[model samples]
Target: MELSKSGLWGDQGDGTYINPILPGDYSDPDVIGVGSDYYCISSTFHLSPGMIVMHSKDLVNWSSIGHVVDDITQISPKLNYDKMNHHGRGIWAGAIRFHNGKFWVYFCTPDEGFFMSTATNPEGPWEPLQHIWDVAGWDDCCPFWDDDGQGYLATTHFADNYQMHLIKMSNDGKQLLMESDVIFHQYKGSEASKLYKINELYYFFHSEIRVESGNEVRVVMMLRASSLYGPYEEKEILHTHGEELDREPNQGGLVQAPTGEWLFITHHGSCGYLEGRTLSLLPVTWMDGWPIIGEDIDGDGIGEMVWGGKKPIAGYPIVLPNQSDDFKHPKLKHHWEWSHQPRSDKWSLTERPGFLRLHACIPLEIGNFFTVCNVLTQRAMKTAKSEVIVKIDLTGMEDGQEAGICHMGTQYCTLGVCQQGSIKRLKYNDTGTCSDGPIIEGSFLWLKSSWNLDGIHTYAYSLNGEDFQDFGGQYQLNWGFYRGDRVGLYCYNEKTEKGYLDVEWFQYHYLSN
Candidate 1:
């Protein structure tokens, strides 16, 4: 069913309304409304072709525009050893806006500090990376272009010390005008601060932590000031975990609908064996010069999710691109990203008629999964049944050519073919530990993995597409340190040098009810 028809789209009749727009792994979202259209971008850590930009007409539906970082060579290459510099350090938090007729995006890599890039158009040839601030500990930088043509950058320091600062940018956004200065020292372990100016007051919406023994409270807090550089006054808590109307307090963004209404878009933790993140939306109204969130009519701390608003000027049902892959084309889908930098020549399908070929390169240390450069991955959008079918021609399998399918994140598993001597073997590995499954003598084999909703599933290998055998025991999908998991293909070096895997075709089928 289309997302709108699924009761997901929020329409505000008088041309603009609000909703928890893009319900995906798009965390730390920052959006800007240019003219009547809205454009948003989010963080992509350790994933190549980082900084994904999304577009929408109303606040309900969104579509992918392009990536800010398109070239892997422009960023760090995929490292061989897992413990290199920053393993998956691409773009983290991004702030997009139009300043003085030029489109600008300010973003940061946790270990790389903050930077800005500009483009004439949203889907453009963005300019080369321009260094704005390079302080190691800072991240989640959001920039605001004021009515006076001045720019202000706000960001949070990493948890290493828990600090937050706001700096002034030169009029042209070429450099920082002054050293970083304190804005608010709530020391509440604040991050993801977005500064919004309404009327004569400027408000800072941020997250704060309350410390207690097993009573930790991470809530969304707000502060307002008359001046940008402020002795600001604190306001009531906006929302928190377990609120009936609000999802658990997580990174979020606030945008004013075209009809002058306000809405909040944020993510909530999906608690279960698979801790995937889901997005949520709530309505906001101004009361006594302060923005009232979730409509606290009873003066309770919690807020409730509500529906029906003036339909946004342009409203479309919330829809996501198909996650399943057919592999009928010569190139990978835009949703797939490499773990680290990838050499273009290392993989290709254009020359091979019906196969996707990946050439194994230098073996990086395999202890850590995030640093594996050749792992191609896509986010697990929603918990659903899915499987991948690949036909592999193992005729040229050398000691160094190990190709397989994987579910990647902090933790991962692999299921595919491995050739040893004259014997072709089906291999399954759970968290770097491997075991032999089934064996076929021929050069071609079909591999399949079936994932039930709970993520524990079975793997099957087939010589003929019609018949299959359970190749391994059931395994559970686990997340190591990160919150989300991705599934895709990987080619690892099994020998000393380079080797290759020839995959005739790959298809992903999502079973429907």
Candidate 2:
């Protein structure tokens, strides 16, 4: 649903917008301005169709355009459904840049080394990822291109005492020279590197943990150097100005608007596991050739997070990332992604004409929904209250097949239909524990879940679309797998892959407080 029309967030229509430009998980945001259009990419750890790419015109309104990687198996087989591992891993943090007439994306998995992909257009048929470095224990990588057509990579080695490195690369960004120079090493937990050459000075943006009054806080930092291999100067550019640094805003990229105004698009770096790290756009003020993020509320020469602000570019109709699926299109929406790489042959849109047909597969671990191969999901909105309702046809169900709507975080809860031989029963599965309900004779079921920003989940079901009966226990939403809680659907079998479920439509609404 559109953010403006829904009143969920963004574009207040009074020339100012709220903090979260988009209301959802959307963590570790990296944005770049390609002419009049702005593109943002977020960390999609372990989510198939990894590293979501979004587009915006006014910086306040954004929509999902596509993803960088389609098949995440290129990173590792352990991330597949059979393995069902790497929950909080995969696609750590990445940077996006418009260079050489192509959109280049660079990122590193925590276990696997660095990888990259490129496309001429952001809504893309992106080139397959190129594994540049095969070494491990490195992450949060960004690429830089010099005026002389030279390429360099700035990354952090977390295993090596939080040491940051600068490595030379071919102009093509495919090969990284093993010659590495330690750039910054003084800070603890320093990472999220983005390299930029602004006005003849090299500005390296990153984040590091610091102890203030016995509180560990993550803050945005900057390193300025005259040369690539630098005698560099460091400064803390942005941090929470409150007495307690709870939601520290850090780890994002800087972009210049069409009006020459600069802004930082970042995530609320802490105390946000429930909804995941959400997107925040802050104003950038350049002082002494360094960009200070947000507003200097206390006038301590450091920027604090701004809750509301003037739009970067005015008068753009508000847009939000895609949220619902009608199952009418032949291809899945850009917002939908599998928990891991899906068994593509088992799910089809054309097979049922106007329904999403999920052919049940035998889960690698029976009775465990987490190991289900084809759990299709999209990011759950972090609103005051949000609701998702899905209608599914159980005519295709066979013995031992279960299909329903779900709310997945670190822990998950499902409300659906479970078939036992010839009898169909309503079931509620909460994190592997099951609570069976009454038998259902109807072929169609409407499953719904309502959640609040507190992460409290309430689920219900209906034989008729208008009436719903609450079935599941009140479960708290969790921020697990380094991701925000998700709203999705699932179908799987405990015995064989003979059953299936047809989803007619999935509707999501952001309820007003």
Candidate 3:
């Protein structure tokens, strides 16, 4: 059902609002307006069914429509677990637009350069990925089709090699005109380029690096010219650091409201250690020839958050779905997705009402939580204190069946119940290894986890629901080198055999104001 809160936090009445419209860890947001509808998608690395597409009428409330990639098998014949080629390399910075009679999406896999897909509708029977531009280190590609039907691809190079470049595309939109490659702009750490035509002049906006602070300073730097390909003049930075409106310097998308108001949408870093990213929107105004961003009538460059303005489109009030699971439904929520191809039979709720049955399967060796098939996780929307309450029945669980709650990614910490002999004991810190915590067997078990904005700090378990003993000291939820961490449930079979854990339900409550 719909969560009580509409946006990130419970809706604040004032125009000033929280930065991220969708609180969860949806990074590198690329938004486009089709007719009167606003559609956006974010990067989903390694997580199968990549590229989540969301719809919103007010630009604040959003709901998932569908995904760009429904099956991973279509991309590759055989997927690997040890070191999957697509792991940590699925959909990155996708740009969606309505062109001609079809809806086109341009995305990058980093290792494979850039690819294009199309559908007659936003939520679609999307075509298989087609290699449009196959060049090393080129990513975050956005294509702009001028009124004259001429197409231009603007993109940035990888950090290890090459630099930002723009090139013209063939009319067929399949290949780039090789000789048309032009270095429109070059900054060592510049990427996520968006090309917009305002007042007859083409403007290019991108984010550059902040070497000193180690944060990617998202500067709305612009370059204007009369021609698409030209001696473009670099203008002053329209948005930069020091101003509270400008968060971490990174890539974002631009859109104009139906009321003729200009707005720039991008993400800001939330937690440096967790690499959590939050979305932010700022207003854009054109002065003289160049555009100024995050400014209002006061001439101050800072953008103030507002609510219920002229409708972006006509629709119902937008509300996000709740993450808490009552186990009343037969299947998991749409918000929960697996890291790889999911085995439907391995998970079920048909046998028992108000309970989720997770059949334990062979555990993999890799520590990357994104590759772990048994893990069920959801994105951490905003920096808040969230707790998960789980009621587990350890009866008949084999010695190898380990069931628990985890804050997982490349790194993780788990607290749950494990069965050994005639007793069931509380378990903790059992990450990447089999043995880590002491056992206290009981018929019924309850597990609880408390996480601050910085990650999970404390975990507790109880034989009876009333008394929870501290199972582990403090554990950090660092997932290797990945940008974000997800929290959810895990049940693994160490026996390389089959067993299952019966979970009563899971309740997640946000305690932060």
Winning candidate number (TM-score): 2
CA lDDT of every candidate:
0.65, 0.85, 0.65
The ten-residue window of minimal lDDT in model 2 covers 1-10
Question: Each candidate's root-mean-square deviation in Å?
Answer: 4.4, 2.6, 4.8
Name the TM-score of candidate 2.
Answer: 0.96
Error of 2 at 356 (Å): 0.5
Supply the global lDDT for candidate 1.
0.65
For candidate 1, write residues 1-513 as lDDT tens digits.
222223233343345443434334666777778887778777776666677777877656666777777664444443222333454465676778777787888887765567788898888678887767666777777788777877788888765556777878887787887665655544656777888888978888877676423555566667888988778887654545443333454566787887887777665532234434445455777777776666575776444344334544554653454555545675565666676556677787775666777776655564544444567766654334667777777765676456777776566777877666556677888777878866667877788877755667567878887697776677776543333666777776645546677777667665332
Give the poorly placed runs of model 1, Cα more than 4 Å off. Answer: 1-24, 71-85, 88-90, 159-161, 179-182, 211-214, 242-247, 269-275, 295-298, 301-318, 326-331, 353-355, 366-371, 442-444, 504-506, 509-513
Angstrom error of the Cα, residue 141, model 3: value is: 0.8
TM-score of each: 0.85, 0.96, 0.82
Candidates arranged by TM-score, highest first: 2, 1, 3
Query: Order of candidates by lDDT, top first?
Result: 2, 3, 1
User: Which run of 10 residues does model 3 get worst, by summed lDDT?
Assistant: 1-10
